[model samples]
Target: MTGAAPATIVFGAVYATVVGLCVGSFLNVVAWRLPRGESIVRPRSRCPHCSASIAARDNVPLLSFVILRGRCRTCGESIAWRYPAVEAGSGVLWLASWLVFGPTFDGLLAAVFCSLMLVLAIIDASHLLLPDPLTWGGIGVGLAGSFAVSWTTPRDALFGAAVGAGGLLLLIGLWYLLRRVRGMGLGDVKMLAAVGAFLGVGGTLLTLFLASLIGALAGLLLMVRGRLGWSSRLPFGVFLAMGAVVSLFFGPRLIAAYASLL
Candidate 1:
């Protein structure tokens, strides 16, 4: 059915919550293992302190955290608060997307996009790096999705990928020429391409602008408080993810506002 019936809606709500939380759990593994060049599947969830393999029953996403009192069963070591935080955050974001778009294709796309944002943000925050697998892979997925759902014409999607990749590369070159330093890393460049693949040229630009503004503000604040030096590195991927989220949810309105202001 194009629209969910009442019973279907109830089922969907429950399923979305459960699935979102479970995905969040997987995402946590991905975030932690990817940077280390380790397979997420190789080692099952274990206690960080004691290396005790977790029982399946104790891996039930948010419930497990509550039940275990956020401690490792074998060692009684406290679990990082981030585990539940990411789980709940992803679940809520997925639920919000479902509420906004229903069970339609748009909802599914938005959900995947949001999940990607979580992965991107986590990796970036941890290592100041964005993996090509996630970035370029996201671009491919977004482009394929655009065609599956007819969100963009094949021509637009192709052009978007080209413009997205090219535009950022050009900016990086210019920045290097001006400063003799790397202003944008290759990871960020790949990320912009991925953003373009999903958002098209206009949406990609909006994402860049929004990310820059947020990153600049945050950096300035840190500098003002003497918490960061002029040369201190900032997490660019986090800003990029935020920009993508803002563009995904409010690009059209923001574009209209910009036009009006101009």
Candidate 2:
């Protein structure tokens, strides 16, 4: 591995941890407010338990979490540990993607995509709802990133985005017609469009298939543990995000293997 050298590994890990910590701070804002139908910008981050304004110094991502011992300074109320975990997790994923794809435009775009997925996973798990702004805004960002990177023709990207969104919408509609219920939400439809815009047709299909597989496994596990009934709703968006990430790293190989199998 190019990252085999001790110095290189150390530098990469440190850089990743720092960036992850900072991004995680912003993610916390998105998590807390998005579901409440509130803008994430107007009100500054405050302690949820005590409502004390957190100082800049005390908001130093992982460092602050550690220094404060995951508690509010004013109320001594313990903060959720997920804060640092998300920040640190995002950083590591971004750094690893950077290393794998190099410093190319695709690498940067992939990092952004992965970060959105991290947010999606966290928010969906917490509330079982994927925010439209994140998914729809991501489509725009992915399209812009594709153009910046010259990864695909503009026509291809546009068509893929349309196909991704339309295809999912159609399926969602059909499911609704037969069952008279909501199946996949609009959030998933928009998210697929964003994924297709970035990954093209083949990758999008692979992502859907992989996501379905993962979702099934997760559902089965939950059912067996008696935590979920057959009718319980699961956040399939998390699995979709997971599938896209996997395909970003190994999509081409999977395509090749499928062709050989055929």
lDDT per residue, candidate 2, 32-135, as tens digits? 89988888887778898989999889988788889998899999999998898888888887787767775567766877888888888888888988888898
For candidate 1, write residues 131-189 as lDDT tens digits.
98899898888788877653455567667777867877897798778877676688988
TM-score of 2: 0.88
How many residue pairs clash (N, CA or C atoms closer than 3 angstroms) in each of the candidate models, in the order given? 0, 1
Task: For candidate 1, report its TM-score.
Answer: 0.92
Q: List the residue pairs that clash in candidate 2.
A: 20-91
Candidate 2 global CA lDDT score: 0.81
Write down the RMSD of all candidates, one decimal each.
2.1, 2.6
* TM-score of every candidate: 0.92, 0.88
